[model samples]
Target: MSDATTISQQLGAAVHQNGVMNSTGVLERLFSHLFHGLVYPQIWEDPVVDMAALNLAPDEDLFCIASGGCNAMSYLTARPASVTAVDLSPAHVALLRLKAAAAQHLPDQAAFFEFFGQADRQDNVEAYDRYLAPHLDAQTRAYWEGRVLGRRRIAMFARGFYRYGALGRFIGVVHMIARLGGVNFTPLLKAQSLAAQRQFFDSQIAPLFEARAVKFLARRRAALFGLGIPPAQFDKLARDGGGDILPVLRERTRKLICDFPIAENYFAWQAFGRRYGGAGTALPPYLEPAQFDTVAHHAHCISVQNRPMTEVLTRRASGSLDCYVLLDAQDWMTDAQLNALWEQITRTARPGARVIYRTGGAPDILPGRVETSLLNRWRYDQAGSEAGFARDRSAIYGGFHLRRHEG
Candidate 1:
């Protein structure tokens, strides 16, 4: 399939191109296409929490799904020997490649910071053309340069890139819902303490749930298309939410709002404020000045492949990789696909290799899908996963799983 159509093909059977709309048929494919179009402009999982579980070393090799390239770039600060960003979406691969190129070739930390840290700068287009453009591969170059909706995709840098992707648009939609329900969450971002945050959630944000529209949208999978929750995963979400997803959403939102200090939580900043907190002390590690040199120096360690996770792992040498950051991709896979993935991970993972992933809903994904014989090679760190899930500042995932290769 061409890059243009890979998304629709990759999400095959999930969305019906010609099938008529039944209760289930029409919406599934439409959502699959929507999700595949712009799944995450900003990664939803916390790389800080991910790094803690992976315990990356200077010599360790890392394999990660390069969603938004945040964690891929952030992992450079840990001094990993290699970080491979394997993704299926052409858009995601292009974005990751762009970040890697920018981090490497941008003149100085300040200019670099302006390009990505403060991405809404008007000079970003010039910066991209002058410095980063030459460094990008042919496919990645075409992606940014290509016109869509009568504008270059790279034009988003000047017009607020962070607020454009599926996740970004989803946040915008939520803000709209909140406003229609008579709640303005901007005050929540300014809350000085957890007490104030909680106070706001209860008094203001909480009432949105009581609104008939909000509740109705919460029950409908189509309403969550922006969050990248697919039809199958939506079913899983409702099931794990005890057949009603409102309380689950409330708990998750509460975590996003109050469980972490706003000063330190970039996810909260993006969710409530629609921006990174700032470039000061609270920025994503990869964007901070202190970490800039390390990330730039090691940016060459990263590589992007627009291929399925299974295909990327298939050609790799056994016992090569030391860390795996799957994000929530596994939530969409079938039992056979899950087994095929672990088979390669098991073969390629080095001793003491740690695999970290998130789930839409869970106990865990591997119990019946991946056979015990294959799974026995790895040790599931239940306690660590629970701790990591709680520590995940993103607050969007149901569970964070940590598995170690004990073979």
Candidate 2:
């Protein structure tokens, strides 16, 4: 088998063994591994939505999963007292570390932009080998040393940010499929008017859902599962649009494709255009610079462990964390796991600590749990949380926000 396939197989086996995909859990292990190990730390849920949900104070110390590290670095812009980012995947950890190194050590903002936004420039490997390589921790250094398609190293984003890696290739394939369907989505890059953009969505994109190819693809439980939807979540996603998931998915895809200028949205640039920062301003951070120093400074506060969420929480100090940002991770847990996680959160959370997560449907998954006196100290912000949910475009989650009450 090819090296890429080998890696995927190994990862799949590891995920299955880890109980990440047990049938009784809320999340499918295989799906979570694919999303977290492969799809995430590339194009993930938007930081803007995360920022809105976090409502972080300038001085609050924060802890979050580093998925792609974009949100971690973006959190720095808010001038938080500190931000700790953690992730289980080594690839994600390496990427986050590299970004942190670059953000802190890079010469200037413009050069930083060029390196990350214009990653196709060809000099990026040298830049990493020269300026960034020596500083990388051994693990991250070894990660970049690994080859892509037998190429020596994956550090060649300088030639083009979108030209390398599995994520890039995945986006390319999606774009190719969309193109084959007779939807000329390229104009989305230059759409200056919302009217024009909306026109594109209504005309060329939305109709794809009703197409045989899309519907067929959507019906496959495995295919949807690969997008990180577990069986329960698959049901929720299907029910959210009043029993027709195809239309809802199509509309969301249209938003990613036609709602914003490609330059402004790294997700679209990566998904439909196969290049980031085509119009000059860098796409968001994950696709921006591969090295981020600002994210690293807060790295000490972040800790990545192979253990499950319940285990991670049990080890933390009580009443210490102010916010818990669980990125649909709960969807992968069992009732026992859920109860265990909440027990830790309740013990460790200070009064007024906030917990946020996303689900696969319009309704909150925690109403029964949160309302019961067992974990009832946490109250739900039904209205505000719903508004936040509606605003999220990832369309992969049903959003929720919970606040801990004072005793």
Candidate 3:
């Protein structure tokens, strides 16, 4: 067998066996795919929560994972000194590079929005070829040259890829099954008042957990993990609902659908309507048009490396970062892994640097660990963190922590 094929098989096997990708493994696999040109932008993270956690200032330098580049671009709105985005996904790196190119080179905000938000249009590819392609590094440029879902040289957002990717499609299937079970969610989508929204949620959405299919699905720990819930997390999510999962989930979905105007929330649109209004009309902060210029100028500050949190932290100079958004990645690690991560975070963090993550249970997982002396350089605002955690619409995360040490 060819060495390249053998390597690919080994990597895939490792990922399958490990249940999650580590830093080096992620990097090697990502580079292999980048060389071949397959990518997915737009991870299923809540930017609102992440941005709030950052509490960024104009002079602070930022470091983040460039998952689809949306959050990285969004961070620019705060006017930080710089943002260095790292990722283990080659496709993600290419997308970030392309976004930087578009933000820098696109003549107007409208054009930029059209290419990314109204991605289904063919003109976006032309725009990429004409305006954005030349600026990309060789690795990224070659990566974008390949076909996505059989279409050549397409942007993920342009091909309706965001709505069709693994997470997107999974949500779609869940919506379909819910509908099939006589849960008509149309009213939840159109509710004009929070009262009415709450009513719809209580009546229509909450009962699905008792459905035979949902129970069957939830029973499979492995399947739940794909929803980003690990075994421990699934147990926690289940327990958070007082051993009743349906009511809690229904209420969360109701808030997402009915809390705001359908136009203002891309999350709701993606969840219920399946698409955002075409072409850039004030998206989430991270996807906003006003910040594109800053994102473009600071694109070089981003990097994608395949290394663990410990390794990534060690590479940074002491007191170099302002924020760390873990995105529930910790749920996949062991105590030793957590200790390794904390060691690096404690070492590299500037005084007052924040660390935020979501948990599967309804409480902060690291209070004792973060509050202790060896790491107690950091402090946690239990009250404020709890409030923010309650406000999260995704409802999947149990806690949202913001930790900073006094200088």
Candidate 4:
């Protein structure tokens, strides 16, 4: 089958629940199309919080959605036995494979960081050719080598790679709107205290949400498809804002900007600056220099698959996996789908195995949806969930849940 056809089929299985004649179905197709390419240049789910909740050990195995593959790569720092990372987007799968190859082959931290950290240097293309290209599979190689507007896609590394993904473009639009409103986000980076950050947001950034145009666009689910928020997830987010998305967005933005110091929150840097802050700035664990060797050493333990989590768990033996990181993908699932997924999760979970997931709204999604028989097998850590949710530097998700298998 053709690549496009294959992508559609994969996405359709997970995302298309309503008929094409319905608005929900149309939104689903549109999201699927947008997601066919890179959606998250950097996964927003904080791996630090994820690792803390999982309390991973060297012998345990993990299964996680590989959005931008950052968390999967970061998990390697914990020296897990294996990380099975899955995604429906071919682009995401290819990106993870590329990161793995780079981790294994790149000469040093300087070269590696220049390619992925600076991500805008022309030498990155040459480095990819010299160091990374030969190790890649034919599919991944072709993905990076493929031309977009007369330039190879790998050259995106040479042209600000983080700024080209769907989420990146959405942030770019937000920046544009801020500029039009005479609001400057750069000043937030300069704020030395949380009080100062709050002052800047209150006086400069918060009013942008009150704009009629911003409110109009916020109400439409399509506008958030760029953030990888599907129609199903958008409804839950709106419900958080009392039937209006603007308040939810504004509050989320406030948390992102003011709840954490900019120097210590890479998510904030990505949102306001569209790139990672350098030097003293916080970075994804996988990108930290101290963790580089460990990541490189454990890179071989990660396996990237372009598919759904339930399909993968179904193929595993009972009690095989010790950890599962669902991110926010469950927010897109139907009740039956959620139950099917939880069935596989319960069937494959080892004793004391933990499952972690986030929701678009402030509640665990599994109860009353998955069978009580299946749900009862897991012990929900309400306090841990609250703690994880509070510490999540990304500040995009409304709830973070941690559940341990009773087995």
Candidate 5:
């Protein structure tokens, strides 16, 4: 069968555990099919907070889930010994590989930025052909050169790539809904202070969540699949919201807008403007001009793999890994899956190793779920986790947990 079919099957195995005839099982299968393609053009987790939580040393090797490859690339700035980024989706694997190749082969920061930073210029398609295409592996080359709806997939960069992915389209629909309600988000981006940001949110954005249509959509499990939230995570979020997700969503949006300055939060730019804030403002660490050389120089340190995190760790030598970045993935895991993952993690963790993950609810998901023996091998840093959660620019998750290997 094709790569897409294989990926769908793999994802189905991981996501669909309930009875096939049950509503939960059906929704899980639907999400896996949708996720088999490109879901996150820009990963929602903030890399700045991730790097801080990881606190990697130059000798430390890191492993992470490669959801758009943003955090993996950004980790290069910390000068880690290596970064192995694994994912279940072949599309995400191709995207990350393409990015790593671009970082090394592309001539300069402006050229790289024009391709990914502007992300809506026609020149990028030509740039890909001239510079990045030949360097990519056959599968990756085919993925970009291939057509979607009769348009070359690489042309997505020329036509605004960030607006085309599952999450991007979700944001676009949110904007459309706001427009229908006579609300505009552009003003929020121009706000000079947190006070102004709150004012804009209170006046222009907050009321939109209360609309009957908005509330109805927020209640539907399918509606949030666009946000990359699975049924398992949806349940956690609903429980946190007292069985109504609207309040949870409203509070998260408010934190995204008012908790950080626009000039300092790139997540806000993507959420509100569908693009980065540009040169003087916020950008992912890897995309910043000053750090471009560092990322490119260390780009070879990153390796992309299409597989589950547990499988990758299982093949690794004992005490081989120093850091792990699990971005809200545990919320989707069954107890057995959680135990299996942590077993490998505990076995592979080196001295002073750290692991950071986020959850849909305010508390960490591991304490009561994973095997107690496996979990007792690590010490959870509650204060650092709360601090990390507070500083996370994305502000979409409820908790950020950091654990240190006790061995």
Candidate 6:
């Protein structure tokens, strides 16, 4: 079966088809449709992991791929002069714009929390209509009001906005699988320490990997579409797993479900529990009430653009941006594209400009792939990168890279 529609712009179709699942025309189309929508209802990468790598200055300008816009919102805490959030997907750009509007206009922290932090309340609808809709650009407003299949997209907030996007539906399926295996690990959400988390995982979640049904289902590449693992990335994961992706998935899921304490681990809460947590829970930085005023004040500094990031950098003035957040987009680029991206990054970066990205497989996806002339301008921070990868709460990505440009 064909799984892609049209590949996301700037992601070469030639690469998409070389892989098994994405090779067929129909499958390619399916991937296109999935990519075109909200892949990450909440982002998969941890911003705190990133914050430790890319030390920001107040005068700096940062360019980031606004996947679900979570990190962008969180990055506002860094007090950068500006954060340019771009994406090839129009839907994602719309999502960023809507979030920015809500952050800027929502009357109180409680209202804002209910709308985005809680993310599953009928009041969010009223909050959207009252505080956010008028502030949204025409494109974004239309997107929220638009219909997907038959349902109006705006109503998704009332029904649990976190549960609607491609990633949301994907997580839902994983829960269904866990239920079928008779291993409900939801009790782990109450675990007080990493020791407790590990104990729970061993007793409850670990057995699923041994189950015939799970091992059978996990072998298929198509099963992880909701996790937004594109075909090229899926190929990387499959090889790392020695032909079957089950082992690779088990290790990553272990990190997500067990390595971190749930009280501070919002990513695990969302992935397994589908909600952030009850009141007084430790949440993502942007969701913390203390940070709300700061994010709102700086929300004006963000601009959402629907375009390929490489093209945006190519068009920018020399030495304009101080940082770039690639967010695993490099995994989708061909060698030529990767070099071109580095060329633009080198040209536009001020002295000490940092580039941070995650990889589905290799940490050094750029060393051979990117042109030496362009790659030489930057130095990869191996220590910081390794630490970020280890400390990352998201646990979905295999590599976290930080490179600094020298003008």
For 88-196, candidate 5 gives per-residue lDDT tens digits of 9877898999889999998888988988788899989998999999899998898898998998899999998899878988999998998899987778888899999
Worst 10 residues of 5 by lDDT: 4-13
Looking at model 3, report the run of 10 residues with the lowest lDDT sum: 31-40
- The Cα local distance difference test for each model comes to 0.84, 0.62, 0.64, 0.90, 0.89, 0.81
The sequence of per-residue lDDT tens digits that candidate 1 reaches over residues 68-96 is 88889999999999999987667888888
Per-prediction TM-score to the true structure, in the order listed:
0.95, 0.82, 0.82, 0.98, 0.98, 0.94
* Per-residue lDDT over 170-219 for candidate 3, one digit per residue giving the tens place of the 0 to 100 score: 67777788779787656755666777766776677667766888877766
Error of 6 at 404 (Å): 1.1
In candidate 3, residue 358 scores what lDDT?
Answer: 72
Report the error of model 4 at residue 242, Å.
1.3
Model 2 spans > 4 angstroms off:
1-37, 41-43, 159-167, 230-232, 241-244, 257-264, 277-282, 285-307, 369-371, 393-396, 400-407
Which pairs clash in model 3?
23-306, 23-307, 74-286, 87-304, 119-158
- Model 6, 340: alpha-carbon shift in Å? 1.0
User: Relative to the unseen true structure, what is the Cα RMSD of model 3?
Assistant: 5.1
**Whole-structure CA lDDT of model 1:** 0.84
Q: Write the per-residue lDDT of candidate 4 for residues 105-134, one digit (tens) a residue.
A: 999988878877778999999999999999
Which regions of candidate 3 fall more than 4 Å away from where they truly are? 1-41, 153-156, 182-186, 239-248, 258-263, 277-282, 292-301, 367-371
| Residue 225 CA displacement from its true place in model 6, Å | 1.3
User: Which residue pairs does candidate 5 place in steric collision?
Assistant: none
Report the C-alpha displacement of residue 145, candidate 3, in angstroms.
2.4
Please give the distance, in angstroms, between residue 336's alpha carbon in candidate 6 and its true position after superposition.
1.0
- The candidate, 4 or 5, that scores higher on lDDT is 4
lDDT of 2 at 357: 76
